[model samples]
Target chain A: MTSRRAFLQRSGLIGLGFVAADALATSERLLAAVPGLDPGDPEVPNEEVARILKDLFGDRPIRKGHLTLDMPVVAEDGRIVPVIIESDLPMTPEHYVKAVHLIVDHNPDPHLAAYHLTPAIGSVAIQTRIKMKRTTWVRAIVDTSGGDVWAAYAHVNVSLNGCG
Target chain B: MAIGEARIRIPDRITRGDLITVNAIVMHPMDTGFFRTAEGKPIPAFFIRDVVVTYGGEQVARFEWTSGVSKDPVVSFTLKADKEAPLAITWTDTKGGVYRQTADIAFTAA
Candidate 1:
């Protein structure tokens, strides 16, 4: 364990130790509370999103607004589903987007990615392609530096599943 | 080291307060490390972890990503333009590879 910690430290990922430890603690606590939870699965269950939200924001409610998630109504390939997320929030120092998250409803791993942001980003828009396991709802959530959370969602119809 | 391509799109004639869309794609395998080669050896994971776009020496957008992104990653976003400027995009990969591309925008009287 010390060697692993040293390796991670040498890799310059020491700042991520808190997040890694939090995720591990959250998963362990969740497994103890939920029955039949698979330990091998890396994807956070859809039901666990609430727990994650609670963990991230204690008692702060997340509202569905202020974001536009552009996604294809029907995706020809599940391997590549293009998505664009734009936020209407101001990028001023007082109110800037801090982070964004991509979540899939039915994938083995629901939490696809998390993006940290800074005020240097003048616009709160992002575009990328994500792999979908099947036809499911995908969501984009944004957290602003001013302590506000906004989100939007879209449904993609996939012809075939792609994630393992 | 691999070569990456990027493109910036704006109206032929830029007027103040016009929204300009920029699209960029990088040539990368984006190996997820979940697949095995024919010899059954697992391929190491390497992908672009961060991409940043700058215009007029100011950052316009930035993206933080992971292996979940598709191969040959493409990103598009819009910026409200007030003046003509050169746009630059830089991508940093997980394997310590840095790629950059730039394009200039010409403003026409509107």
Candidate 2:
């Protein structure tokens, strides 16, 4: 354990190592709580969004429509670009939105965030801010409990790099 | 201000079965580790990795985030105000820092 810690420190990933360790433990607990779901790697950064989606969905068809992705056409400050996502999908116990994944195609890490939701949320409405490394396409993908995937995209021109 | 400090907001007036919006903001650097300091030292990645929201003792939403989120993140979502219960938001960061805050959802007669 000490050797691993030392190696992580030397690799400039000491922070990630600590977080990954905790996240792994938590994911294990969550796995038991929610079966048949793969919690993707939270430690790695800059992974391709397509690869991440493929890993999660496994070639499932992602259809377009049924959702709205809103963002500024041009962001003078990429550090905090406001984004809002809403879906017209029903949120009933029989069928609901299982998750919403946010992706930035040009960021160092394209897979920005994922929100796992329940029917108790009443609606598939989300408003958040994100960092953009540069001008990119932001995609919001929704997974429904009924085994359907819907997606929407918005293009944003960023004047500054938010990653720095 | 301390790291992990958070604030939660809910509608002032809620009715039974009303779909209400909940907002939360947490203070953190959300450092991406891709930048460097003036001395050219590489900044390590340090940011919130997980966020959970619970209402009436049940999990309503969970968010997994990467460094792509802006610093001092703000997240908003909608919840069904079916019961008057405590709505809690918790944020856990890369450095083992956990911050939490809760707001009560009081409902009026519809």
Candidate 3:
């Protein structure tokens, strides 16, 4: 009969093996999506968000106009704050909104989400619920495939932090 | 049984030029890995990372999200409908789980 201690030892080793394998597989898929994403780092800091945006958009100034962002001014729970973004920019083959980068200023990972849009949609509007670490500014930066960037910002007051 | 339940909402009928809102919600834990359970074990992070919406075989919205999104996320987007077609919504979690749902849409006059 196998001793209890021996069984525990074998199970512990098997658990470790499974964890290591899972990490390896996850990193491989994440690398393909975010090349610079670090395997050791689970979340990107606020400073990292700025760097990522700068790298993606270059030095172009993102003007705040022609975009509408809707979100409640106050949220009782920061865990599920509804947000909506609408762009008046025309969607055409020559000129269209390429993507929308949603960033929360105070979240542990400020780079909250991103959405890629196409002209086939005939419109550029997206809505999603995001979690906030605290009361912060959620900004949406819209990239118009034509070397122009537009942004819209909304402040959400959270009574309770969500990312703890 | 699947780990999540996904539902997609599309308008019953809309004008050709009208913008219709499509909403999708998936029930998920969205654990951020920063919290420790009562047993002191940190829950592994799990969340839906990619959301793809396709209409009439044309991809419209592609969203990438992380654990920063809330539990049971609600994703809504609008598209101008020129013709009636089927809409496909798919959500891919971090663990390679894919949940997909399709809806047939028909448009009416303005």
Interface RMSD of each: 2.9, 0.6, 1.3
Candidate 2's TM-score: 0.81
Q: Over the stretch A1-164, how does candidate 3's per-residue lDDT look in tens digits?
A: 99999999999999999999977765455443444333443333344565666676667666678898899899888888888899889998899998988888778778888888888767777878888877777778888889888877788889888887
Each prediction's Cα lDDT score? 0.72, 0.85, 0.80
Clashing residue pairs found in predicted model 3:
none
Whole-model lDDT for model 2 versus the true structure?
Answer: 0.85
- Enumerate the chain B TM-scores of all models: 0.88, 0.95, 0.90
For B12-97, candidate 2 gives per-residue lDDT tens digits of 88889899999999999999999899999999999999999999889999999999899999999999998889999989999999
Tens digit of lDDT per residue, candidate 2, span A67-153? 999999999998999999999999999999999999887788888999999999999999999999887777788999988888887
Q: In order, what DockQ does each candidate have? A: 0.29, 0.64, 0.49
For candidate 1, list the clashing residue pairs, or say none. Answer: A43-A109
Chain A TM-scores of all predicted models: 0.69, 0.70, 0.70
lDDT of 3 by residue, B13-110 (tens): 77776678888888888888787899998888998899998888888889999899889888877777777888898899999989888887786755
For candidate 1, give the docking quality class from DockQ.
Answer: acceptable
User: Over the full model, what C-alpha lDDT does candidate 1 score relative to the true structure?
Assistant: 0.72
Per-model TM-score, in order, reads 0.70, 0.81, 0.78
Candidate topping DockQ: 2
Clashes of each: 1, 0, 0
